[model samples]
Target: MGGNEQKFIKEAFDTNWVAPMGTNVDLFEMDLKTYLSNNVHVTALSSGTAAIHLGLILLGIKAGDEVICQSLTFTATANPILYLKAIPVFIDSEIETWNLCPIALEEAIIDRIKLGNKPKAIITVHLYGNPYKIEEIRAVADKYQIPILEDAAEALGSSYKGQKCGVFGDLCVLSFNGNKIITTSGGGALVSHSQNIKSRAIFLATQSKDKAIHYEHSEVGYNYRLSNISASIGRGQMEKLDEFVNLRRKMQNFYKQLFENVKGVSVFEVPNEDYFSNHWLSVITINPSETNGIDCDDLRLALESENIESRFLWKPLHMQPLHKDFPYYGGNIAESLFAKGLCLPSGSNTTEEEKARIQNVIKCLFKNKIKKKIKVKSLFPKRQRLFEDNMLVNFFTKNRLETS
Candidate 1:
């Protein structure tokens, strides 16, 4: 955690503003508005899932209304659709960016509309901090005249063409869960372009209390307001957001460099300069054929064996038994990603020793294959270094060649 988290959190206790509403919550929301670089209204909530649920409510989603969703995200993104008893039409991810495929999205929209139930809203996600195909997806949503509930939970610092991720949709969600880039310990916020919508969201979050001043409610409500203490932590985390983003990007670069010459392993990256990701979790796809049959799980096990943890990418929601019966579009792209992708340790606080250990583990795991891929410099080269005689490569090569 950033050092100032304690300072802001202490202020919350010192002022006795420990509940959900107070100076901290107000300022934290303001901080997010300013950081989002948009004229969007913000209402801090208890969780990202809550924000999505409220967003769907504000969009007028009712039971049996179909909501289009990206199938490759965390369950939280899609669970809210089920919460409102709305049908979730899951879409697949494209290869360019492992996000909602615009083609599949348009296909789903057309088919659903033909079936007489036009989707109420599209729930798009910037999975793993990588922004979706912003323009393409937006075009599809606009053409279909469907509002979007962007799940920017993993994308607080991510952007596309200089615009931030959270502000891209009609109603957006941001997460500060413990595992997120910057955590309020556990919290989230909803983003909207309309102030009235923000006010309505706040009203619903606080038990829908009426103006009579007594505990009164006319509609179902949720205790979804973020705590003053958590907002205080968010305030501090906001201060160090740029620092965390920079460090996370460095981790991405580290993985890119480490895997540059390694066959079969390719680090996940944006397609172009238009996208800037927080690199929340550096991911890679391991192709078995190119790595002497080593796959993502093999690498994960190797890392685990060394006490360095790694994980597979999210299993597509549609593949889950709970969600298998849901209407789904597209082929096996999400399934392919789940099968081959691995999430590397990319925390902001990872130390130099930890980095070295991680590097050593990976290097050892792929040593045999990588040895054949890297070349040793020739002798008498300018600014020569060790192994100028092509010693290591030639030695290994000669040993194999001699045997052969």
Candidate 2:
């Protein structure tokens, strides 16, 4: 928690504003608006998923509608489609940003149109805080006249071409879950370009309660409003949002430096100067064949042995059992990423000692792998002779056999 979180919560309690709607919620929304520097309205809600559900509702998504979703994101990005009984047409990620591929997105739209199932909305995600090909994706969406639901859940402080991520979509969503850049303990907000959209979202979020004297209901509504206490936490987290982003970016740089000389390991990074990521989590892709048989899962297990936590990247939603049956566009890019990527621990609160421990584990793991290669090389004098003859195939074949 940030320094001011407790103070704001205490204020909420002292004033007895413990319910979902209060000054804290209002101020939290205002804080986000000011931080975004975009004239967008924010309606705080219970979760990022809830915010997504409401965004779809506002976008007029209904049963059997098709939504284009990035295939390499958290399930929350796609699950909301099911909540509305909508069909999700998943699109693969591009190699550059590990996000929705613009070309594939357009192809999906074209084919869906051919089948008379034109996509109602595009749900693009800024995966792991890296911005998607925003201009390109926007171009495709604009060409198709489809609204975008920007899932900036992992990209609160990220930007593309000086514009913040959360404002890019027709309706954008931000997550303040425990693992996000900022935490409201558990909450989210929907960002809209129009005040009316924001007002409608708030109205639907609070059980569609009309302004009548007696209990009334007109349409189905959700109890998705952010509580005052959570909003207070969000306000506090907002104060430190920039700091947290900087820290996480620093962690990314640290990983870049740590693996600078390491073979077969490449840190994921912004493709150009125009793209700026929050670096919410530093991730890398490993090629086992190039690294003497050290794979991503190997590295994860090595980290686990040291009592340090690491994780494989999100499995492509298109490949998941629940979503596999859904129509998916594009090729093996997302699949390859899921196979090779690993997410290193990158909490804003990570300590130097913890970093040193993680570094030692990684370094030791690689060092041992290299030593094994060298030892195997020593066992085959004929293969060593082949090295002098530049017969690389024989050398590698013998090496593989010995390692096997």
Candidate 3:
């Protein structure tokens, strides 16, 4: 938590504006607009999944319409398609970005068109906060005349060729969940190019209530507006967005240095300087053939034994039993990566002591023969400590995470 969240929350209570659509929400949206540095509109919502659902609806998605989605991502990306009763055509990932493969994406669109039901939109993601091939993906989507619904859920600070990720899609989504680079306890936002679209989304989020003396609904809507308290937390978190991004990137550099000399270990990173990643999670792939057959699971188990948390990358949606029957495109690139991938300890708030413990576990697992010694560096070396107290978070937790 940032130091200012409590101050904002306190103001909310003092003003008795603890409900949704308060001053905090307004200012938080402005903060996002300024940071995004684009002429776009943002409406805070309940979660990224909600943002996706609303985005699909606004994009004219309907029952039986096909929507192309990245295969190797959180289920939230695809579940929304099912919510709208639309068919999801899964596309595999490219090695350069671990995101939607443009070739496979185009193939899916062409084949789906040949099958007589053209996809409504293309869902692109920046997996692990690394920006995908934005230009490439956009080109393919344009060629096929499909709108892009960019899931920048894990990429709040990411960019491609100097433009922000959220602004690239016709409709985009950003997540501020508890485990994101920054959090509002739990929330998300939908980004659009026009105020009219933003207004439409706001209306839908507020139960499609018409401007009547009393609540009146004419269309299907959701109770997904973010509460003033959550927005207050977000206002504080926005103040620390750049700080959190730098800290997350610092964690990525930490992993890069740790595995620089490890023959079988490869840290996941952006393909080029044109792509900037927040590196929300530092991930690596293990080639068992190079380290005397040490696989990803072997290293994961080692970390587990020491109680240093680690886990495999997301299993492709196409491989999940729940989604196995969906039409999938492309080769086994995503599958291969999953077999070798593992997410390391990459929390921004991790202490020096905790990092030392994690480093010891990894070094010991590799037989302590690593040439370079891992450093227990401070995440904030020259600034005042940001986290002043756990009082606010503790209080919120005690209150069952507070109301919407």
Candidate 4:
């Protein structure tokens, strides 16, 4: 919680505006609008999932429609497609950004069109706060005249080519879940370039209440409005959103330095300066072969044993039991990422001591693995001689030992 959260909440209580519709909600939306600076309209809602569901509805997705979604993201991205009874054609991630592959996306759209079921929308996620190949993906979508629903759930402060993420899609979704970069306790907002779309979303969110004196509903509606208390929190969070993003990026740099010399591990990073990730969660991919067979799960368990928490990356949706039967396009990139990637503890509030503890545990694990490999090699003289000669020649050739 930021400093002004309690103050805003208190104002809500003092004004007796405890309901969902209040000054806090209005101010929160405006704050987001100004922060985004994209001239987009925002409709704060109960959850990111709710925002996604409403976004799909606004996109006119319905029964029997097909939506193209990234296969490497959280279930929330795909669940809403099912909510509207739409078929999800899952696309794999590209190696560069770990986002929806443009080639696979075009292939899916072309094939679906050939089958006479043109996809209604594309749902691309900014996975773990890193923006996707925006220009390429947007070009593909434009070529097909398909609308994009940008899932910026983990990318509030991220950008591509200096443009904010939340404005890239025809409709974009922002999450304020407790684990997100900013928390409204638990809330989200739907972002749109059109005011009419925003108004329609608000109408549908608030039970489709008509302007009549008496309560009247002409269509199905949802109870997805963001409450006064939650919006108050959101208002406070917005004030510190940039600070949190900086802190998270600092954490990413910390991890980068920690693993820079670690042979088997490579930190996930932006492909170029044009892409700016909030680094919501600092992640890495471990190649066991380079580490003498210490894989990502091994490091996860080692962290757990040290009473520190780490997690494997999201299992690609195409492999999940519930979504396995769905039509999946592209190669094994997403699958390989699931096997090798690990997310370190990267909370904005994580203390320096905690970070030191995480680093120490990881360093010790790698040191021990190296020692064990050396001991085993010593037991075989011929192989040990060959390995030592290779190491010496490579070390001299690269001058790494001299630098150390």
Model 3 pairs whose backbones collide: none
Global CA lDDT computed for model 1: 0.87
Per-model TM-score on C-alpha atoms: 0.91, 0.92, 0.90, 0.91
Q: lDDT winner among the candidates? A: 2
**The 10-residue segment with the lowest total lDDT in model 3:** 382-391
* TM match of model 2 to true structure: 0.92
Residue 58 of model 2 has an lDDT of 95
- Tens-place lDDT per residue, model 2, 206-304, is 999888999899999999999999999998888899999999999999999999989899999999999999999999998777888777755765676
Q: Residue by residue across 255-371, what tens digits does model 1's lDDT show?
A: 999999989999999999999999999999988778886666556655666678887788788877778788999987887887778899999999989999999878877878632
Root-mean-square deviation of each candidate, in angstroms?
Answer: 10.1, 7.5, 10.7, 8.7
Candidate 2: misplaced stretches above 4 Å? 371-404
- For candidate 2, the per-residue lDDT at 36 reads 86
> Model 4, 1-404: lDDT tens per residue?
76889999899999999887899999999999998887999999999999999999999999999999999999999999999989999999999999999999999999999999999999999999999999999999999999999999999999999988899999999999999999988999999998999999999999999989999999999999999999998888888999999999999999999988889899999999999999999999988789877777557656776678787688788877788678999998887887778899999999999998998878987875552221111111221222223222221222211100
Clash count for candidate 1 is 0
**Predicted structure 3, TM vs. truth:** 0.90
Error of 2 at 65 (Å): 0.6
Task: Using lDDT, rank the candidates from best to worst.
Answer: 2, 4, 1, 3
Q: What would the C-alpha RMSD of candidate 2 be, to one decimal place?
A: 7.5
Write candidate 3's Cα lDDT for 1-404 as tens digits: 88999999999999999887899999998999888978999999989999999999999999999999999999999999999899999999999999999999988888988989899999999999999888899999888789999999999998999887889999999999999988999999999999999999999999998889997878888999999999999999998998999999888888888788888899998898999998999999987667766666556655666677787788788877788788999998888887778899888898888888888777776764332222322212111111122012221112211111
